[model samples]
Target: MRSVLVTGASGGIGAAVAHRFAAAGDRVAVHFVSNRAGAESTLRALPAEGHALVSGDLGDPEGARQIVDAAAAELGTIDVLVCNAGVAPSEENRHVIGDVSYEEWTSTFRRMVDVNLLGSANLAWAVASRLIERGAPGAIVNIGSRGAFRGEPEHPAYAASKAGLHALGQSLAVALAPHGITVTSVAPGFVATPRQEPKLDGPAGDALRAQSPFGRVGTAEEVAAAVFWLASPEAAWCSGSILDANGASHLRS
Candidate 1:
C-alpha cells in the first residue's frame, strides 16, 4: 500500500482526499494545523490500519518542516503529497480594496500568501527531497481554487496565492519529472463543506448555485476523487495539469 500525506486533513476537502487514499488501502498521515480532534476523527474514519495524525502550523517554516518530517516518520515513506492546507476568505479577513483599511488589506494578503503559497512550497521541498533520495516514483496534488482564475474581488490575495500555487506545480512538474515525481493541481469552485453550509442555505445560496450551469456548487468528495486519480501512478503523464473541478462554474479558454 502507498503511504500518503494529506495536509489540512482535519476536514473538508482535505479530509475527503485523505479518506479517498485510505479507502484505497493506503496508509495516510492526516496533517492539521490545530484541530487535533478533527484529525483524530479523520484517522478513525480511515478504512485500514497504519493511518496517523500529524499537526504543525504551515505558516511557520519550521512548523512546515516538522509537519513533513512527522509524516515521513509515521508513514515510513510517503508516496503521495496532497497540499490542501489553506485559509479561505471569511468575514473577518475580507479585504476589499476600497472597503477595507490599509492595515487589514496588507495583513490579509500577507497571511494568505504565506500559508497558501510559501507553506505549500516548503512542504513540497521536504517531500520531494525524500522521494528523490529514495529514488521512488510519487505524485503531488495541490488543492487550488477557481478563484485563482475567476478572480476574488473581496479576497484578491487568496486568488493570487492560489494562482501562484498553480504555477508552482507546473514548474515543479517539469523539474521533478526527471525523478519520476509528478506534480499537478486542482482548481475547485465553491464546495459544500460543513463550514460553507450556512452560505449555501442562506440568502446567497441561489447566486452561488447559479455560478454553474449544473445549478449546484461542487463537493469535497468530487474534488477528492479528482485528487485521488491525480495522485495515482496511472496519471503520471498528467503532470503539470491544472484540472478543473468547478462544475462549469468558471470556464477558462
Candidate 2:
C-alpha cells in the first residue's frame, strides 16, 4: 500500500480525504495544526491499522519540514502528499482593496498565503526531492478553490493565494514529471462543510446554490473523491490538471 500524508487532516475536506485514503487501505499520516483532538477524531474514523496522526503548524518553513519528516519516518516513505490545509478570513475581516486597513489586510493575507501557498510549496519540495532521491514516483494533490479562477469579492488575498497554489501545482507537475512525480490540484466551489454552514443557511446561500448547475452546495466527500482520484496511480498521466468540482457554477460565467 502507498503511504499518504494529508495536511489539515483535522476537519472538513482534509478529514474526509484522510478517511477516503485510509479506507482504500493506504497508510495515512493525518497532519494537523493545533487540532490534536480533531486529528485524533479523524484517526478514529479510519481503519485500525496503517494510519497515524502528525501535528505541526505548517505556516513556518521549519514546521513544514518537521511534518514531512515525521510522516516519512512513520509511514516509511511519502508516496502521496495532500496539501489540504487552508483558511478564509471572516467577512468582518474582509474588505475591498481600497477600503481594507493596512494592518488587517497585510496580516490576513500573510496568514492565508503563508499557510496555503508557502506551506504547500514547502511540503511539495520536501516530498518531491525525497521521491527524486529515492528514484520513486509519487503524487501530490493540492486542495485549491474555484474562487481561484473566479475573483472573490472582498477577499482578494485569499483568492490570490489559492491562485498561486494552482500555479504551483502546474509548475511542480512539469518540473517533477521527468522524475515520475505527478502534481495536480482540485478546485471545489462552495463545499458544504461546517465552516460554510452559516453562509449557506441564509438567502445569500440560497442565491449561491441557485447559480450552480446542481442547484446545491457540494460536499466535502465529493471534493475528496476528486483528490483521491488525482492522487491515484491511475491518474499518473493527468498531472498538472486542475479538476474543477464546482457543480458547473463557473460555466455560467
Candidate 3:
C-alpha cells in the first residue's frame, strides 16, 4: 500500500482526504499544526492500520521540512502528498481596504502567504526530493480555493495566496513531470466542513448556498474524492490540472 501524507489533517478537507486514502487501503500520515486531539480523531477514523500522526508549523521553513521528514521516517517514505493546510479567511483575519490599519494589512498578508503558498511549496520540495532519490513515481495534490479564480474582497490576501498556490502547482507540474512525479491542484468553492457549520447555520446560510446552482455548497468528501483520484497512478496524465470543485458557483474561461 502507498504511504500518504496529508497536511492539515486535523479536520475539514484534510481529514476527509486522509479518510479517502485510508479507504483505499493506504497508510496515512495525518499532519496537523496544533490540534493533537483533532489529529487523533482523524487517525482513529482511518480504516487502515498503519496510519500516523505528525504535527508542525508549516509556516516555518524548518518546521515544514521536519513535518515531511517525520512522516517519511514513520511511514517509510510518502508516496502521495496532499498540501491542504492553509490560513483561511475568518472574522479574525478579515481586513478590507480602507477599513483596516497598516499593521493589520501587512500582518494578514504575511500570514496568509506564508502558510498557504510558501508552506505548500516547501512540503512539495521535501516530498519530491524523497521520490526522486528513490527513483519512484509519486503524486502531489494541492488544496487550492475558488477564491483564486473569483475574488475575496474582504480578504484579498487569501485570494492572492491561493492564486499563487495554483500557479505554483502548474510550474511544479512541468518540473516534476520529467521525474515521473505528478502535480495537480483542486480549487474548491464553499464547502460544508465543521469549521464552516456556523456560517451554514447562520442567516447567511441561504446566501452561501445560493452561490451554487445546486442550491447548496460543496462538501469535504467531494473534494477528498477528487484529490484521491488526482493522486492515483491512473491520473498521472492529468497532472498540472487545477480541477474546480465549486459546484458551479463561479465559472472561468
Q: Count the backbone clashes (under 3 Å) in each candidate.
A: 0, 0, 0
Candidate 2 lDDT, 1-253, residue by residue in tens: 8999999988899999998998888989999998898899999999859688899887899999999999998999999999998776577768686887788788888988999899999999999989999999999999998889888887888889999999999999999999999999998888888878888897689897987977998999999899999998899999999998999888424
- Ordered by lDDT, highest first, the candidates read 3, 1, 2
lDDT of all predictions: 0.94, 0.90, 0.96
Those runs of model 2 whose alpha carbons end farther than 4 Å from true positions after fitting are none
Q: How well does each candidate superpose onto the true structure, as a TM-score?
A: 0.99, 0.96, 0.99
User: Once model 2 is optimally superposed onto the true structure by TM-score, how far is the C-alpha of residue 91 displaced, in angstroms?
Assistant: 2.3
True-vs-predicted CA distance for residue 80, candidate 3, Å? 0.6
Q: Give the top-scoring candidate (lDDT).
A: 3
Candidate 3 global TM-score: 0.99
- Between candidates 1 and 2, the one scoring higher on TM-score is 1
Instruction: Write candidate 1's Cα lDDT for 147-177 as tens digits.
Output: 9998999889999999999999999999999
Better of 2 and 3 by TM-score: 3
